[model samples]
Target: MRDPAMIETVAVIGLGTIGTGWVARFAAAGLAVRAFDPDAAQREALPEAIRQVLRDGGHGEAAEALRLSLHDTLEEAVSGADFIQENVPERQAIKADVLGRLDRAAPVDVIISTSTSGLMLGQFQEALSAPERTVVGHPFHPVYLMPLVEVVPGPRTAPEAADAAARFYERVGHVAVTLQKEAPGHLVNRLQAALWREAVACVEDGIASVEQVDKAVVNCLGPRWSVVGPHMAFHLGGGKGGLRHFVEQLGPGIQKRWNEFRTPDLAAMTDTLVRGVEEEAGGRDLNTLQRERDRKLSALLAHLAG
Candidate 1:
């Protein structure tokens, strides 16, 4: 396999939000990007949209340094590309089909990564000719700013492929977390789902409003987690005795809390969530909200780095 650090050209399949973010990120990192999107309007708008996002994220120089080529066909996009980032729809069949085509069109050495939010690598690579070279490179939304990109490998995937992906992600200023085994929703999303289920349940139980819950998280848990993960935080909570003493003392209470946690009825909570979100949005357009989010994220990232 080629050295991932030497990868200079990338093919981004699907120019949706995630794909566009990948494009901007790679371009900002000084890689030539070949982008493909079936939707003509999306293809036309991507360059400017990406440029604006880059600027918003304080990567204005990357926007000027951006070397992007928009393509109409998949084959054209993958031609001579060293890496391929697939951001197609999350459906299993759709990913399988797209990945199969990518495997056929790209050279065997070119690493093909899927930006699936919560799908298994094996499901998509089952039919691929070169499954070993394919891995899941799931990045969080607003990929340009988010530092995390989960690197998951299928059962048949080569170890080198996953390692290379980790290296590549780190090269582009991301925290690459390589999983030892495959699981649905990978790691972060599963943790997020767990927390979200509780948050939804809190609202369902009339314990707190959506805004209240969000504020609580942002004010407390969010900053704490950012500084130190849950395990370490709890270790500190244990005081002088650390995790072992804390667990022994608090285990029963923790278990009780866990048992009380409910599986929320999402269908029932949909309207409630929509109304709450709309109220929180307060008539701000998506672009405005997104820009503000990116700006704040950038500032937070800088502070954390310091």
Candidate 2:
């Protein structure tokens, strides 16, 4: 549980998909949440969205525990917040603007963790006068349910800032993976992008359809990956020799596969990919699909916990 003294109140600076997820997670942890967004429609819909996310993720009771307030201005939302989660668009300019305002308004000691998946923190932390307090708290989708939060430090970030961010995330039911050194895309995203490039290549080469690609992961890679990462999986593949033996046997093949990887021109295949994905969706609207995804994910997480 979040210590009231440390992070009882949180400010969410944007109301996009990721921002809403942060609010959902923070609220579910019984934190006092104050959110601000320029979009009137988003502001109006936020409360219900948080509720729905909580209910869908199997933490419905936490909805009652949430003490949420919406503000028209950024400053109002951040006032007295012990921690801030910035969810602005991925663009450096937009992030710089919002974070600048936050840096000016938020308490100097408060942590300003962002939701950037790829951009390194040094690119935008310039706006923060207390740059040491700003850190990357990159999270995966359905942020309320996903346990992983990548915490990366910027060029000027104090080591303690990253530590504090990790502590805050842990308190809010997340596993904070701190990077030893800041990387451009961070760890998980870089790995995902590598696989994504190849997945796109498969479709571009006409070797697999979009649906088939998804099925390939679902049937093979997905299950094993859920239980153990690729390194450990390959280690087990060595049949008791571990990673060293596996690498010795498979390094050439792995290098060969990497040599063949290429990205498809996304624009050329956009229509086909979209159509194929729609077919895979099977007439289920986004809300239905998301609810089902979260439900299954919750079950999987519960089983993993056991």
Candidate 3:
């Protein structure tokens, strides 16, 4: 269980797509939320969206009383909050300003966390007075459902703060992995980028259609991933020999494949990706695509649960 000190009122800054969902997740876990978005109009829709998800997740009546105090200013948002989660634009300058503002405005004891997908935690930490309290709490999109939250501490970050944030996440039904070093994309995104690189190369080579590539993952690796991670999967695949033995035997083949694989510069492949999405889901409404993704993700979560 998480220490009570780390799991209290959570103030979420910037109510964009990811931020709104974060609000839902934290609020549903029964934490009082104080949220802010510079664009006042965006704050209007948050209540319904959060309530809808809570209803879907079967929170029902309690969802109605879920008090999300939408604030007009960042100062109001962080006032008296135990933890502050920044989900602002993905720019270092913007983050620096926000961190600076938060450091000056919020109480020094509050845990300051960011929802940056790939940005270095150190950059934002430098702007804060108490840099040691800043933590990188990166969560995937649709934060309510995805269980993974990478908890990274910057160069000057206090060990106690990182552990406290991890315990807080665990208390609210999240799995937190503390990264030992600050790196671009952290852990999962590195693995994701490696696969995405190959995926782009495959598309450029015309080896697999977009749908076919997605099908390959969904039908093959997806199910297995639900049971175990990539390393453990291959470990089991080696039978009695296990990973070390299998790697030794197949190291040459793996090297050969790596050399044979085409490498396309990712920036140059953005249009290719846009086209691939158009080809795979061209006419589908975004809601329909979301429904499909939600269905598969829900099933995967259930399988993992068992």
Candidate 4:
């Protein structure tokens, strides 16, 4: 049975990949989900996508009992929702427009969180009457399986609202990472972009092929990263003395020795990246790749759970 005190109804304001994932997870958690998307195909395809997500998570029984409703209009979707998740496109104008609409339509006290990967909530929250209740709840891809949700509050967002949103995500099986203040690309995305930029630089300068870089990560850093984050991993790298010794030993020379690349022109490298990724795919289509990824991800998650 569903928890009596848990929020009963969730409103998902888009039906794209992230939104569909959210809908699946919510339904699996026993919340009634109301969703709206302008695209007819996305709406039509959602039921099966949801089934796949639940199936990936071993929620096949929940898929049968899933209480998911599709609505034609945003207003109709947000109606009676105890919480709202906005996953519209990443444009500032579009997000502002959708958020403004949601602000007007959603119950005043309900929190509205965006699935924006990097946009700061302050940019669009100003147009809303309930800006205090608006926040950023950015999740990684495959939201049902990924544990982290970066919860960022706008300048106008109330502290209590941020706290409440974090608690809600935790309740639904997410690790809520709350930032003290929102930055240019939030937290994780910015870190990822930095590494991605460096990777492009590496390829541009002939330091490593795409395949080599990927192999290095997969065979070396990625496994360690799965277990320990940068600080802890580096601290362990310090032998017996830990972070203080590591910093003392390597801190001064770090920037001068390692900061050697400019962000390569993405346009110039587009073809290179595409060809490299294609070669890496080895003729496997997207569906096959996705299934393989999800399978491995499930095994890893189960091991982590134990």
How large is the C-alpha RMSD of every model relative to the true structure? Answer: 1.3, 2.2, 1.9, 2.4
RMSD of 2: 2.2
The candidate that wins on lDDT is 1
TM-scores of the candidates in the order shown: 0.96, 0.93, 0.94, 0.95
Model 4 over residues 82-200: C-alpha lDDT tens digits?
88999998888889899999999976688899998867888786678889989899998888888889999889989888888898888888899999998888899888888888888
Residue by residue across 170-226, what tens digits does model 1's lDDT show?
998999999998998899989999999999999999999888888899899998998
- Candidate maximizing TM-score: 1
lDDT: worst 10-residue window of model 1 = 118-127
Q: In candidate 3, what residue range of length 10 has the lowest lDDT sum? A: 1-10
* Clash totals, every prediction: 0, 0, 0, 0
Q: After superposing candidate 2, which stretches have Cα over 4 Å from the reference?
A: 1-5
Give residue 170's error in model 3 in angstroms: 1.0
Ranking by TM-score: 1, 4, 3, 2
Candidate order, lDDT descending: 1, 2, 4, 3
In Å, residue 151's CA in model 3 sits off its true spot by: 0.5
TM-score of 3: 0.94
